[model samples]
Target: MHVATADQHTADWLMRFGLVRSEEHLNHYRRQGFAWMVARMFPNAGLEELCAFTDLNTLLFLLDDYLDHQESSASPENRDKKVKAMIDGFIRVLRQPKYGEQSGNPVFVALAELWQRMKKMSSRSWQRDFIQSIVAIFTAAIWQHENVKAGKWPLLADYMEQRQYLGAANIATDTIAVVDKIRLPRKMYEHPLLQELTALCRNTVCWANDLFSLSKEIAHGDYHNLVVLLSHEENISMEEAIVRACEIHDDQVKQFMRLCRYLPNEGPVMKMELHRYVEGLKNIMRANIDWSDYETSRYQYEYEEHVRTHKVREHYLMEAAV
Candidate 1:
């Protein structure tokens, strides 16, 4: 099965990252340590490249915020610190003038403008909409660029003429279709020609979903209770929860690896590798907890202790209760 292979690949990758030493370790890492590791491990590529394409740092930061808020007894000050740290990192990356010693990446230019606009938006809904719009635009541009690079000028022209109609539709879905439809002159996926770019696209989609989920959690202030809620919803034991979390983390890592195979020679290989490192860091968080030792009734104490030590703050406790 595709899922089984993906799961096995993920597990092996996690082991290499030292993220699955034990169930207890997994829990601790997931609850408290993951965010810090992710923050430290994010890719060092310029902001322009990241914004133009899908990069992992933004998503990791979003997840870090989610975990910080979900821990019981998370403090207001701690939450603010995490948010500030994330924002500072974003600004640091974005302020850099030179990205990859290249020029005339229109997608990068568009993304810069979108990021600037997003930085100015105060409304959460508007910000989400803007991000979605930017992603759609970027996807379209990438597809067009791919066609041009492949020497499919006729198709490129066709796409340009239909751009307005296509732009009004869902970009991610449309781009996927475009990728499927394109007739490569040769078997491209295995050619080692566009491996990095392919991987970037795959990683970008996964990262985008991760970001979307984290943003939803933060906007609703439901971070602290997410794990407990997931356990309850699945009607699984704490041990089972740990197992599932490890499994999910592993799958994500494998997907990243698969994406790496699609990169072009000039693409950001280091950047993608750094993204994998962040994945390893997240696995560390998942590996630190011994979920099997705790009874359902003991969730509160374990969670509270985790939160207190982690300096979590400003979660929507009452809202999450519902």
Candidate 2:
């Protein structure tokens, strides 16, 4: 739960790139304290590691919001195209870490910087894995958009399967190795126990997020949430859905605890790395809950007021066009 001193510096860097435009935008970004969350998740990161990871997390928060807003507002035909372009841009920069240097898009520029820094310290195998996790996130985003456009409500099982990637939990977990420069043996990294633990960690954080952010998503006309889906699928009240969601989240936490208590012996160094990695995952779960409950104003936003303002802007634009 320790916060990095470099959190403000990361926010300032984002502001410099014109990401935080108005006072409202700045307030929105700062209130979430995304960098603070990053710091907690990687509590042992060195100053340089902390700064780089914080920058990545902060930029991602903005990118996720941008994609969600665009997908929700744009015509179905045009929506996928924009998200696909973003995915391609990310892949291109990942393939050639310097490719973003020539681009004018701020997203690409920031991504390239992150890629360059990450590539310097991480092995090629690690980089490839990280890229795969990121691509999975984009793919899941497109899937969510498709579901929304089709007015589809995914079954609870299906949503849980894809939610791990969509929540970007894999990407955040992968950073455990990157920030600490701890590379586990290939076999150890791929062990079933480790894989299960990772999934448990992802589910715990994401479901808790689904619970905390349910109100905000409902206000935004977004149903790609566990509580909403649970409510729809079970034909239950929102209160009942929330209780069910919490039960599921608690189950995951219990499993994570059970797995942590029985980790196999992978020799001393490998065992230590495994412990640290899982600990980082635990930290992320804790940080998410703490930040969502106390540090963020995101879920407390005046949704109706925002909708009214948006309508006013639309009408003003229509009048000007006429």
Candidate 3:
């Protein structure tokens, strides 16, 4: 299962970009084990590609923190306005042909640098796909926030459909080409079986995340996870919901295997690229599991002290939620 050798390359790259301004932020980043997760997800990645991958992951983590904590705490009247502005600003930065200094937001600035680097490093279509995937994520977060505030959780079908963006797996898949320097033919990439394979990979990763973060989400009064949604919508107990969530993840894995048996036929070069992409997805799913299992900081109550505990009881570290 140790698909990749561990390295501190990405952790070191954090400072090179000067993304974290304060000692507090710096300490938080170090504690996150973000770089290691990226490396695991992209087992064969070179230093430069791994660093870029980790940077995007870290940037998204910061944005999610802002949404779930800071943006959520704002008054309802201000929350919607602020979230939209931030989303729009980020979208503009990502969609732009070149980096611009319009937004003072640190995340936006970091993203612009990333966009430039990705533009030069990846194909034009890959760049477009990445932007679209990220934009969907931001937009979906905003919608989810509004739905929760309105006390209206979506139906299971709708939720599953929209969760694609929340998981941000499209961007993760797109990274294979840039990081591995291999490109699958567009037709093979778009084939239905390949799409199903990708959906299974994305679902497994997101569902596992739902299980891992269930307690934290509950304690924060956030109930957007599949586990929470299932329990609430189905009128089932939390224990039952967790079991159901695991079943969904397992079933997806089974389907992933079935789909992998019949991947699209393509030229040798394209077949190799497709194989690499599939392997990349498998590694990403495994990385999510590894990260949640080992890196307790994100879910741990006493992250600084390392109690090796879990869950989101009120007595837990309220400060860690942000």
Question: Where does candidate 2 clash, by residue pair?
Answer: none
Which candidate, 1 or 2, would have the higher lDDT against the true structure? 2
lDDT of 3 by residue, 201-226 (tens): 78787887777777788888877788
Q: Which parts of model 3 are misplaced by more than 4 Å?
A: 1-21, 97-99, 301-322
- Candidate 1 C-alpha lDDT tens digits along 183-283: 33234334543433333333333322222233344455432222323355667864454344334434444454454444444346644543343343322
- TM-score, every prediction: 0.25, 0.88, 0.85
- Candidate 2 lDDT trough over 10 residues, lowest sum: 311-320
lDDT of 2: 0.76
Clashing residue pairs, backbone N/CA/C < 3 A, model 3: none
Using lDDT as the measure, what is the rank order of every candidate, best first?
2, 3, 1
